[model samples]
Target chain A: MAKGLDIGTMNIICSEREEEDVVFTQQRNAFLELDSSDLTETMLDSAKVLYIERDERIYVLGEDAFKFATIFGKDARRPMRYGIISPKEKDAIPMIKLIVERVLGEPGYRNEVLCISSPGEPIDLDMNPLYHKKMMEALARRMAYETHVIDEGLGVIYSELSDYNFTGLGISMGAGLTNVTLAYLATPVMSFSIGRGGDWIDEQVSITTGLPKEHVCATKEKGFKLGLEVEYGSADGALSIYYDALMTYVIKNLNRKLAEVTPPKVEFPVALAGGSTLPDGFLKMFERKLREAELQIDISKIRLAKEPLYSVARGCLIAARTHEGEEIGSGGETEEGAG
Target chain B: MDNTSSPGILQRGALIYYVGSVTFAAGIALLAVGTAFITISRIHYGSEPEKIILSVISTGVGTTLILTGINMMMKQTRYGYYIVGASAFISLLALLIFTSNYPHNWFYPLISYVLTLYIAGFLALLGNAFANVILWMIEGKPEAVVGREREIKIYTDEEIERDIEEATRKSIELSASELKFKEPGVEEVKLGKTFRETRGNITKVKDDIGEAKSLRKTINPGERMKSGSVEVESVSRNLGEILRKGAVQKGRFGKIKEEIKDEMKKFYSSIRVTRNR
Candidate 1:
């Protein structure tokens, strides 16, 4: 499998003090070079492990695993969901498993200790072992049946949240789910993601349009904004229905969360992340909806994370790092010499 | 007529002429140097007259050598098989004449020893000329300048010297085209392609004649002027009747004499230039 892909939901978070955003670079347009961290290690003796966090799944790899998927991992354009996998978490395992195989290039350089990411707080007190098990079983299968196996817990770590010294809410608004994580101490404290993201919006659009889900998905990227302010009864009438449905749902969710919650209140500013939030005027739409719901926050406080496309991976990097920023493996400090 | 039009042969002559002139000047100096030795040999030892004579001798030798060396280096160039051959012949002749003229004191040695050496050198040069000619005949080198003379010839005037240039230009076109066609597998004939194509009415008439012959052959001859195989008697043809013809109706002899007698006429000469190979 060459650079397999994962698909997930994307959402935009609008709050009272923050206008939703995704800050990629700074006031200066200059962008720093993207690090080849996923594929490299600082020291030769240190074993390299790459962690990829996608909307639906998390990919973990070691050694030249990232390079194994080099062909499919063409940065020229990262495949959001361009292949066999639907816009879902199942995509990530195959994506990373293929990535590992691709990087190694030679045969027999593969190892199969599998893991996948779960939602922030699991919403339910009980762990749904069945659902996670199914996802991991599928992940292991994608790895073509190797030995070792494991499950990684959903991470809420420090030092990985805000590389820019930002202390705001970081949201992974994906296609079928929404996750919000706050950063202070350079890492996210509480993060929660559920099935209420871009895919849901597209689904509503599709239900109204009687079109396929894929069509609705494409329309969100391009046709979503073009349908606004125009009469709803045009040929885009059904799509408008999906649009209204998403807007209403997003508003309700924001209102319920913000109005109901008190002490564990979010930080003043909030940053939006994820691929689904890439349309024009998306922030304004969220803001207007938030204001109408009487749940508006500081519009100026919002910022968009850089490469909303790679927030999870970046956050995963931060989460995967040790106190010294040198990433610690699953083995404790005692095994530091082993790697 | 060709002689009048293009001074092609003349230009080639001019090139050789220039070279010969320079060589001639140098040979004169060399001869003078040789003569100085004579003066030096007659001088008295330790006398002031000996010093003066020695200086004179030195001047003579120095002047001759400098001039001769310069001339040889300038135009001992490789022209073409034909032209080089001609120049080589001329040089040998000049060498003989120049070497023959000194007093017996110097002349005997120059004639016997030096002249023998010259003959051998001349034979070697002739061998070079023969080989070059053979090479051109078999596998021609486009660098050969012999053919280019026709072009140079046309550039000179016979009638009005200015008009002569057009003739020279035309000649180059002709010669260049001729070579190009004869050189099978060639695609371009440089200036010659245009000239071959612009033959005007001459080619048109030829084409017409061909078409007419083919058309006439399609008809059986029996239907025309067949006075059925009558007499085999030979009759005296009337030369007087032919002589009574108009000015334009003259026979071939008249046409031959129409231009300068005995000279083959042409509107132009041929010359070709190629990048130095």
Candidate 2:
């Protein structure tokens, strides 16, 4: 079976269709480093946690790294920053490669089809998405997979807007960047990104509230909700305020960009997907912001993805399946037999 | 080519001509005076020794001036007339002064000076006129004009129509050849058809997948997370509990702090941190 991968800033998720179900495997795309010693190595060996040993030192990886960082009062480091490989991290590529390998595992067959979701080029940052796309494709190819890169926002459309003929706007509120795609009849007409997302909100809230970034991130992930009105006295409240600001900025830019194009004469539903959109009442806040901005397009509805965090991976799986089917058909094989 | 427009060259030539005329006039006056001096010396002094020397000197001076005047009249040298003119004028003055004060008294000297001056002036004028004539002949020729206008040729209607028809025919032929050159080959036709079909198939498949997604209910991430059994759930819960307890137990800050510390110890033991750089 083909696999779909979402190499997100926060997590690396691999999805595969097993029978009638979609199964996902994920690894935290983060790490923490510590001075190496005999005792430390023994402790790490005994704990059996995911780690990499390099240059006479050890790197604690995955979700456990953050736990260790909190105890040590040190910040957990991410291999990815702002949705691409962190340029400052010396071991970013190697660490990401290890995580991707663990999450995707070995291909079931040689040259197995794999569709990877890649973020659109950022409009507000000098980051090159092409390098990231090529790197991920190279990684997947190394694992014996025939890889394809899909736009992160378009992947959201493939996952959530199948009923709309893929003609709506898809916004993936990821941790490092908010990817926006406007599609018409399954074709992407415009795709761009703003370099602000969950991480930015957490960072702003952390700074404003004088709390550790880890604590802020933990608070946000632990079922925090943003309402029409926020309580300014609490950390969650601070986070909510920032979330609103981010939504407002995104909407304003979206409207400005949309104004430049001649939109098709069809109503489009705005679909929000990604880890940042997991907060409660996020759909309502987004809808309110869009209405307040008075965008030019006819938005039918604003709905959240059933599973925001896995939508990109699921969309990638869908694309991979379709691609596999096409390959089979072109090779003179029966589609039903291939399925 | 117009003499009036280029005054510099013409002005120099005219001045030279005037100088030559003056030289010629002065030479004739000197020759006349020398002849009169010799005739008076012979008639009145009977060729006395002192008078003979004076007559010979006067004749030699007159002969030199006449030769200079003839040379200045030629156009062989540039500014040659100025030399001749100055010499002739000086000699005429000298002769007039010498004859006026010496053996010949005021009457003979006065008569000789007046006749020589008048004759010199007249000959200079005549030479100047001839110089001008020569200059005009050399400079006023029509063929010497530097720039000349060319005649424009006009075509007949028949010729113009024939040229237009020829150009149109050539252009039509070129267009026909270009069209033939750009005609699609068999391979190109097949390639284009395959490309279109592939594009259509891709669109169809995308639509099919989108339709399929729309029919499904909202995907529950909680269910998927539970199935994956990721370590984030435990970490998030533990961290959340500590933060929540810390916020709630503000009055027992010390106890909450100890509890947090204890919890961190337990969590850190299960994980490992290292510096890999």
The prediction achieving the highest DockQ against the true structure is 2
**In model 2, which runs have C-alpha deviations exceeding 4 angstroms?**
A326-339, B1-277
CAPRI level of candidate 2: incorrect
For model 1 the TM-score comes to 0.32
For all candidates, what are the clash counts? 57, 5
The number of the candidate with the highest TM-score is 2
Per-residue CA lDDT of candidate 2, range A226-293, in tens? 87676667997898889989999899889877875678888998889999998898888888889888
CAPRI band for model 1: incorrect
- Tens-place lDDT per residue, model 1, A1-339, is 011111222211110001122111101000111233323322211333233333322233332222333433421112122111233443343443333233212212253222222344323233322333344335434444231211111111111223234344555565545555544434333444444566566666666657666455555666456336656544255555554566567556554544423323444455565656566555666556655665533323555554454444333322222111111111221111100
Tell me the interface RMSD of model 2, in angstroms.
25.9
> Candidate 2's residue-wise lDDT over B188-275, tens digit each?
1111112111110000011223333232212211211111134335655777787898898789889878877766655544332211
True lDDT of residue B80, candidate 1: 31
